[model samples]
Target: MQKRKHWNLGAKLAVAAAPFALLALLSISLTLWVSWQLDGGAAAVNEAGRMRMQAYRMSLLVAAGERTLLPDARSEFERSLALLSHGDPERPLFMPRDEDIRSRFDAVGQHWRQYSKHWLDVRPADNRGLREETARFTGRIDALVAGIEAHMSRWTALLNLMQLATMALAVIGATVLLYIGYLFVLEPVGQLKQALERIQQGDLGTRVERNSSDEFGTLADGFNDMADQIQAMYRNLEAKVSAKTAELQEKRERLEALYEVTSLIATARSLEELARGFVGYVARAVHADGVALRWSDEANRRYVLIASQGLPAYMTDGERCLRADECHCGAPNAPPFARVIPIQALEKEGLQYCSEAGFETLVSVPVRLKDRLMGEVDLFFHAEVDLSPSARSLLEALATHLASGMENLRLNALQHEAAVSQERNFLANELHDSIAQSLAFMKMQVEMMRTSLSAHDETGTRAVLDELDAGLRESTGDVRELLLHFRTRTNSEDIEAALQATLRKFEHQSGVRTTLTLREQGLPLPPDLQIQVLHIVQEALSNVRKHARAGHVWLDVQQQPQWRIEVRDDGRGFETGDGPPDETHVGLHIMQERAARIGARIEVFSTPGKGTSVVLTLPASDPTLLDLPPLQAVS
Candidate 1:
């Protein structure tokens, strides 16, 4: 059989009733006993008073010579008085008293005096003494009565006082018992209830005070223990939740960083721009000095610096190229502050060589596009700093992003190069088809006219033939000029030679005088860049021939730290505006585009009725331009 669980009501009622029941029973029993003692004391006092009066009476009778008052009676009376006098009011009446026996002796003396007084009438001389004794006896009887009255009064007063004290004590005891029950039991129970309510409301830290070693103290101790356990459990749970939240936050940050890097790399336009952005990102993410990108030039047998940030200006602009075997990027013998690494390997050998140089520590990542090695990236930092794993991981991710961006940039460059080549090819074909055909047809017509003039009999026939021959010669010169323009494609051609040739052709075709000016010599230019400069010159010449109705033209090509080409014509010039026209003249637009492609600037100056002057300026290439690899050559 399953044991039944006790109800809370039953348990609480038992606890509440047990102490009260015990106290009530004890109080009632004590009260009853005390009342009985009081009653017995009152009865004993009454009996003792009566016995004292009887003893006084017997002693008086004995003084008066009254034989009716027996000795036995007197002794019995004295014994009763002694019992009353000796017994405690609060105790059972059972003991004797010597004071009661002395009262009996006084009664006997009073009785003897009374007898003498009675005999005084019969005897003459002896009667006088007897009469005095009788008077004394009367006084003794009165004193005995007074003593008996005083004993009775004292006994009654003591009984009354005891009864009153017992009643008052019982009332005080009941009140104290009620107060103790209320404080220890009811008040504590109420406090416990409040504590339980707080605990139910999730106040796990709430606890009760244990004031005593009683049951309530035990209960309070148990409550405190339970609260402590609950608090500990909650704290542990909170710790776990906080830890999980932190981990999630870390993961979210990583994802966000990854997304940012991806977006940045995907939208970057140029290597320099990409490098600048990459360095900022890595420096902020990993707390590094800066980032640098270098590429290997196979044709020149050197590694060329492409982009850098946070490096000295001299290092960035100085000899950026280095031989493969002589690279100082990761060399121990290099400056301690330098951070150098080979990002991509040209051949099968891995890493080429990596060095921190003057930097304390460095991380390198190879920028590879479509599995082909493109270049290397180096991240530098001070020696005292250490990169966290998360930061390092982020940097690696950034490196990957840079690699993809670099690949896209290279692809775009290739596409642009292909498009330019195609345009050049189309232009060449058009020139050959249009101008060459027109010149050929004009030549045929002029020849036919010459033949017809030779057959005529008129005197102006020679003059007509001569005019036809001059027209044919002019047409032939125009075709030759067009072909010469086509031959000046490569930048390697001498600038002075190309300019002189174009001006001479222009003079012959346009019937204009042209002068060539050279301010400096040995203008070294990279082949591709020089091609762009030559094109700008070509566009300027074309504009002058078509628009400038000038009789004489001046062409000046100056070379110093910068390349400046100026073409001026003494023709009717148009009004100067914000910039050259965008659509009405495609030549100017083409010239601007060419200048932009080679990182040059173009300026046009013109006034109404005055000559138009076109100027093109380009930053001078390194003096050792020829010693470097071709821009398109893979290194």
Candidate 2:
């Protein structure tokens, strides 16, 4: 459809005032014309009255026999008649166009001509007759003046009438203009304002009416279009906000479930505890009817149920263990990614447990760490379950946590076993170095004594017996020292206090004077490091008592940029090519192993006669010891 043509605001206002404008122009034109006509009217009356005086003067001049003065009077009277006929525009003098005024003016002119010719020019013998003619002439002049005055009065009245009519039309035009403005501009503007207010008050449906083909009409259409767009945008915004709110709520639930599972992983001590907690939380998180967690062997040949929730007793017992081909849930043929399986489909493959238990669907999430599929989490539901991508991802994340927890527990068990084996080897080394060597020497001495008895040498036999007694006494001391070392414990955390106690015990037992000097200047060692240091000190002390044969021993500990401990004895020292071999002195070997465990170095210094010193030096910063690996058993 073609659009209708419309005037803009400026055009509309101009059109409305057109008639009044024209009326004003017409009234002004008429007033100017009437005033121009009246302008000359007074001058005509004055000129005519002067002519009457001139006519009376001529009659006087004729009667006085003054011919020269009479000529001047006649010229003056005739000039007045010409002025009244032609009108003097400069003096603003003019005769009216009315025929009565014209005729009266002409009669005055004719009377003046006759009186001048007969009485003044010809000198009439009777002065009374000339005076009478002059009198009639003046009367004619009076009538002409009256005619001019009447004409001016009528023009003036018409001017007043034009002005009054103009004013009345102006008032009417203004009233009509105001009415039109209200209908087109003010009323439409007010409607738009009301609609805007309603829209502000949340009423999106408000609109304006298009009442005319003008600016106001265009404005009304725009307003309605704007309202429509706003309403549509508002509706779309509400929908998006609702969708976001629901998404946020779902994420919050997932986070809560993950937190619960994390707490279980942190505090749980065994795989059983972790799996049980995990299945319960997973069932609640995914709204499943039942959940089962299972572990797969390295060959992927069998599955073992670790924990289960909301499962029937019969189903749990029957499916407690499954070979690779026994059940689809535990089968190696299942895909690595998390999946949904129907119980009826499983039943078609000869797995009747789920169908018998009335489960319609099963969600099996593979528990994996990197590429290793360690286990599976099976969720059972009576109704078929459709999981969203986020829900599926959440399930997979829970499976990963389960896998990590299981792996951690396995590593912990392996570390405990290794520690036990390491301790056992240490005991064997100690016994072999000390007690076993002493027993071998005693056995050889017993053989020497029997040989001497057979030879019947009294001095040799007596000396062999003395030697055997000494060997027995030395072996007894070794056994007691081994027992002491084995039973030793670091009851206090303070390394200084533990060392002090060890020194006092060594002095009392071995009957040796000992001095302990500790100079501390750095942070205390970690408990594991401290234990290793203390054990090395005790072993050094044990060696001193058994072999040093010293009168006094000094144990010095310095804690600073590095930790250093020196066990020095004033004993008949052993000869050193680098020091005694570890095979011969097992205490030295044990101390070296303990030092290596804490990332420390051990050194032995000895002289044939002066003394022997065993020094253990540990660096303050040992990155290898920061995250120490599990101790490997050594024999």
Candidate 3:
């Protein structure tokens, strides 16, 4: 099998991590952006402050040159002038970028050039020009210092505001992220956990209702699927118990019912009591709100309500009869099949019998044999009920049991009856799908052969003869298989022995060393299902004998989640594809058909020159269906 892609734990974690990842990214980017904004004003303000310091140094050097005549001070003053003229003295290659600070330095340079020209000749009389220029420069220097200070104060205020805003943004983003985590992550997960706890406590109906197209939704779907499977398991286990209980109880009841009905009919006393008793049993067994037995009087073109249990006033109107057209029992001309049907709202008022009792559904079971509908037991339900497949099957079986009871009543009227007639009816349906179809094919072949023989067409006649031979052989094989099925009725307890016998027969016929392994402790299948399984195994082995030409074959029956049966052979295998069934591999159709009837899955694996294996898996909860082989020969 190819690997299928699934969103696993890692994917779920990734989905959960998305919000936090976004939050981290937001915090880091916001901090960097805010820090960058605050730092923007600092460079210009720092540059302005540095230029003011250079101006102060130049003023001190001019004062020293005017007062004490320090040569070093003059030299340093000239160096400071050169440094300020260019920009940063420590790194003279660079120029200042702050426009305000650079413009103040330009004013300082203009004043210094005039002050230096005058102070270069420092005479007492010309000291007036120097002092005047010095005063003006000093005033400009004060204003420059104040401007730099004011710029620093404004930058500090803006930085503080930005930091506050950034902190608020950070808090808001974190809070939003926390809220998102709580709403989308923590809360949903908590709900899911609580649901799981409830499920662990045996609440199978608990659901995690995630309505998003995200991981949570997928998880919800998975949970629901698991719940469904677990619920199915519970139902299957319950049904199995019911089946076992019913198998014991129903068998006893059926026998008792048959005997009592036989005695009642034989005595020719109180058929109404019998009918009423049987209807009541059915109503209680199937949990119906009410039940009524209605006898069909086709001769009078009406059906008369005969007996009832738990019925209300509106249904029979103190005993009533209905026309053929008004009958909702079944197809008038067909055999009665027990069916569960819902009450339609539109037809509610018209159905007087159902209207008063307030039933949502009904199971109409005709006490019938074929189209001879003697009467019907209608089971009404006041509310809807979830009917499992097995329950429905059990109800159907009970209906048939009732029909058989009614038929026995009639049969008792006559002193003697032909057993072969009942057997014939069963054979008719079985053969219709199998032997009857083959016979129809044979008839066509025979017709063609006759035409060819009449035309004196030797080649056509010979081919038709060959075809007839093959068809006859297939029909014969079918008969033989049916004979084996009818004669050997395998039960759960007898399956091991039945299989051993089958294997011995195969070994004798094919000269292949056949081995049988029964590994389910002992096959624990329901008795009614054992025969079908036995038939499938028999057909598979028969196929191996006819086609495989193998030296050995292995038969294994085991349980692995379900019952598994494998028939493998070490023989040359054929290519497989959809086409016509090959003559070499006989009984394949019969095996597949039987598996299908039992709701079992069957697979055939083979490779050319390698080997062939047939595997069948039968589920425990599989419902029984009508798979009666033509056990009687056609008359």
TM-score, cand. 3:
0.32
In model 1, what is the error at residue 271, expressed in angstroms?
2.6
Candidates 1 and 3: which is better by lDDT? 3
List the global CA lDDT of all models: 0.61, 0.81, 0.65
Best by TM-score: 2
After superposition on all CA atoms, what RMSD does each candidate show versus the true structure? Answer: 22.3, 9.2, 26.3
| TM-score of each model, paired residue for residue | 0.36, 0.65, 0.32
Lowest summed lDDT over 10 consecutive residues: which window, candidate 2? 626-635
**Quick one: best lDDT, which candidate?**
2
lDDT of 2: 0.81
Worst 10 residues of 3 by lDDT: 88-97
The digit string of per-residue lDDT tens for model 3 on 1-635 reads 99866555446556656765676576566656544433533443444445445445545555555445534544655665565455452332222345785677677667666765565435344334444565686666555556545655655676576567667766776786667567666877898899989989998888888656567778889988998998889879988998899778855665555455455444543467667776666665556788877777655366678778787766667447766546454235534556666764435333355755687777766666565666666777888755556556555565555556666666654422343554455345445645777788889999999999899999999999999898888677666655665566654455678888878866775689988887746335655577678778877876776567789899998864567899999987777664223543356666776688677888888876776899988866532333433232233
Candidate 2 lDDT over 150-266, as tens digits, reads: 888888888788778878877887898899788767888888899999999999999887877778888889999999999999989989999999899889889989999988888
The full ranking of all candidates by TM-score, starting with the best, is 2, 1, 3
